[model samples]
Target: MTAFMEPFRIKSVEPIAFPTAAERRAALEAAGYNLFKIDADQITIDLLTDSGTGAMSAAQWSALLSGDESYAGARSFRRFESVVRDLTGFAEVLPVHQGRAAERLVLSALLKPGQASVSNTHFDTTRAHVELAGGKAVDLPAPDGGNIDLVRLRASFATEDVACVVLTVTNNGLGGKPVLMENIRATRAICDEFGVPLTLDAARFAENAYLITELEPEFTGHSPRKVAELMFRSADIIWASLKKDGIANIGGLVALNDPDLAARCRLELIAYEGFPTYGGLAGRDLDALAQGLLEVTEPSYLRYRAESARWFGEALRAVGMPVVEPVGLHAVYIDAGELLPGRNLPANALLAELYLEGGIRASELGTLAFGRVDPAGGPDIPSARELVRFCLPRRVYTRSHLEYVVEAAAAVVKRAEAIPGYRIVHQDPVMRHFTARLAPML
Candidate 1:
């Protein structure tokens, strides 16, 4: 079957609301320890996620949804084009449905058999598209900071049949760590030498930009807007997920400096989505996305998200669990390897435990980490492993929700320790799970 026609089996888990605050409180107390979960009460503090609900001004909202023909058709391309020019100053733009869709277009347009695209790390969907297009997905060695190792990446481009190099602004796979500015400049130099195009996966670009100015003291006084302009300098093509960075609905766009490349990508888009005018975005969502892009630059918007993440991180550490050393933009991770001692509980099991305990949703990074590869003359397919991810989507949550997560997580961890030897059963390598068999961990 073709890549798009592949069927995925669904595993549905029902969500149930906890009876009361007190009942949730009892669950944590019964667990005997409170370490490892986020404090719910602080989740919503400075919430500025693009999830449709962030506070946008009436004018901003109106500008987005006005559906007037001037802002809707071929003119709509200019709506996105103007936004890209105003925000990052890129020369050309093509709107798409969301980030991954942009990935599919870029990879399909540029990659060929025996070719490869390298990154420090990649979002799962991005890797899938590269491999699906008959190319290799190469990653730079992990840096000490869990960011990409630029030196190794520089070397990869020198030798490999590299079609393009993608650099995600904040390494989402690695706790949302921001890529250092120095690395961006170095990678750009390497790409310029090899005649390779550099594409940016900027799904969390705003958050990464916010971190550069706020968290990095050396970058103090630098604005997120400035940071975006600086980073885009290295990229020939920029792909952003409007849902994550813009007004939190579903839309994406690819901005490029080369007119020919942008035109080529647009041709492929027509078959999968629609015309250049409405590439899968509703009239209202396009408006929201434009407003959300502007909101990301606001100081108050950045403050709220950063503060909430910081507060959640602090509470997790106080309880004795290993949280990602420093918090990044949206989601957080609990090091399951550290949480369950001697049990060898894979991250997949921890994710399942979290789900069964309270209908809380999370990802099993290990099992879900997929990428395709071609060995000499064969087809590309996904790889497998086991790790868990807790994605804290912005705006939809409040502080109380975070506290509930932390408290409920603590209770589950306590219950896990009592099982003599609980382990994850590898039913499918692509998606692992916990079996009924339970024993004490030695």
Candidate 2:
């Protein structure tokens, strides 16, 4: 196989430091063995998350120089809004601090008490926001990664007051799989029948569009941008974090054609985030976002991004690691429970094992992230899979780095059988993965 090369050249570098096993052990203990709590300085190969971790390109940095800092009508905001409009074909764009902020704003406008907001799967924050606002975030089961259970979607609309039907284009919570365009069209048709609005949690829409261009024969010859424009037609509103496929460090926006809905969202955006123009972001952020919007869907860049992810996932699988079958666009999820047998062994143990083996830090996605804890904070509901996720940041890390990660995985495999289960000592009811404290069960 030809080596997957990054399409861009590096302009600068940051030195990484490795910690000794003894030091890592101490760090893990200090962090309550929760990998999320471990300091980045001690992590040799930090793969905890892809959010805001990607290195900015030289052009993005250059665009920052021309940023207009005016509070009300920055030229940077105009460029950002215009670029987003051209790509999404939505008439209105309201910027926000990040994707969840956009989600919150849209939900605030669309949802009422006892209303239901449905999706393929709600990522951590989306669910929290929905529940916090006195609404339910209902996740419909999908048999195949691309196909949603239409029966479930219709059932959600039928049983309760359906506020909006949400489709996460590259479903984030469940292995980053792309939703098929046909399913999306079908969803829109269902929403139309129910008189409910259809929105997109489109953080990875560009990546999903690229997958459609590559996999679907109906769109065989389309570019990612064109595919994205076509896909946006299926949703009444689109929300995305600029951090993901946007290739920016921070920023998010909601795009919609509905005048009343857009006005409602903008009012909420100003009350919570900021002015519609900058939206709690600096003018430089808008400039970078404008540049990122243009660069993200370039056909060459999309192909390289997809191929590079496949290269990483395939490389690990080659070493006998049990990864999620069809590789996700941004991350590789290792089946930790399968990696280490015995129902007694827990998924959270993989974090400490991988860190100790090679100073590699990966996020625990299975039980530690999704498991529900009771009133006393012990695990009440166990999650289905035990997954350890390594999310690749865009325009960062190369084949060489991935090879090191594979070596880390190999090292974890050596002592996998010895790894033990864990119990959560303390956790928040919502989005507990980030702040949950766990201790290895003896």
RMSD of 2: 1.8
Candidate 1: list runs displaced more than 4 Å: 1-65, 69-77, 215-218, 341-345, 370-387, 419-442
The parts of candidate 2 lying over 4 Å away from their true place are: 1-3, 341-345, 374-379
Q: Give all candidates' CA lDDT scores.
A: 0.64, 0.84
For candidate 2, the TM-score is: 0.96
Q: Which run of 10 residues does model 2 get worst, by summed lDDT?
A: 340-349
RMSD of 1: 10.0
> What does the lDDT read for residue 141 in candidate 2?
50
Residue-by-residue lDDT tens digits, candidate 1, 202-261:
888878888878656767898887887788876788898877777555788888778887
TM-score of predicted model 1? 0.79
